[model samples]
Target: MLTEARLVAVVVTSAMAGAAPPGVDDDAFLAAMAEDTYELVAGLDSVTPVLVTSMPGMEEIVWPGTPVVEIPDLSGAALVRAAFAALPYGEQAVLLSGDAPDLPALLIGKLFRALGRARLAVCPAADGGAVAIAAHLPFPDWAEVGFDDHDPVGALRASAPAPRTVATGPGWHRLRVPGDIARLDPGLEGWDGTRALLSG
Candidate 1:
């Protein structure tokens, strides 16, 4: 999938900040998210992936191979914009949620291949949000991204020129609440870190 594609997966997220999800506190949430980011970086071995964080000194905790991109304390669209801007222009820039750890390596390849056909592609979450986005170069003004709004997936669709859609199932779900973890299967391959954290 990355043969001639300048693909970079920007794991866009922050440390635990808001209310804790059920069955876990802020610390556990942070750990779980770290594991998620770790696996994502490890899984995408072909394309260089980076973890975008607002927290200082997070590089030591994230997966070793992946690099870290720190922004000046931003959130929502601003944070996403900063992360994307830091990376060199690529044929495809995939913005992924660090909290959604269950994405297997196969799915990551599929998303990149889909981008080859469209200027932009998104794997929409079941809740009208987005779990991942693969956009072709010359990124749009992220301020209009409308993150945390009612329908960010819809917003992205409108911003690009006929953006393509990638199919996703339960495995692609994002971890918002503690119960949302149930959507993942610890037994599955490539999610060892998340499995260990959630199981223990």
Candidate 2:
């Protein structure tokens, strides 16, 4: 579906220092994300992915051929704008968090399919947050909505005057806090890419 349509998969990563959790090692997280991203791309028959990350020092950790676009920081609206601005125009971009290990490739396709009808399509996190957002149009103004807080979904819904929005059925989980990792399903136990971090 993505091959015929203009689409780009934007994977946003953090700088070396801010790459991982507060206590986890940055290199490990980068490596894990790189692996997971490769798996994500391999699983998809369509969609071209571009890996956009914050500043250097992590180049040695990610997969080869992954484009690394450095940004200032992850907080605030500037980061969102910078990330989107870096993307090539005319293609719908699907923004995926580097840490969302459970991101299903099938769902990614589903998101694009939904985007045909809805201005915005999101996969809500298990923690009442958003794990992914796919947009057919150019990036939306996230500044109008507060992204620093935990619940970006609610913010997007309230702030954006989008004509329509859709979400996938509940099940997706993001690995934010340590406890959040443990909430993953047992089937993912064997996928070390997801298990190492999610399975406490």
Best by TM-score: 1
At residue 101, candidate 1 shows an lDDT of 65
- The reply for model 2, stretches above 4 Å from the true place, is 1-10, 15-26, 55-64, 142-148, 162-171, 189-191, 194-200
Most lDDT-accurate candidate: 1
lDDT of each: 0.59, 0.57
How do the residues 1-200 of candidate 2 rate in per-residue lDDT, one tens digit apiece? 44535444444455322435556676676567555754565456666656667735645544576455666666545655666677654467666666665566666777777777766667676656556667765676642322233665566667667535644433476666555556655664223664575334
lDDT of 1: 0.59
TM-score per model over all chains = 0.77, 0.74
What C-alpha lDDT, on a 0 to 100 scale, does residue 141 get in candidate 2?
Answer: 60
lDDT of 1 by residue, 19-65 (tens): 24545556555656666655665556667666666665567666665
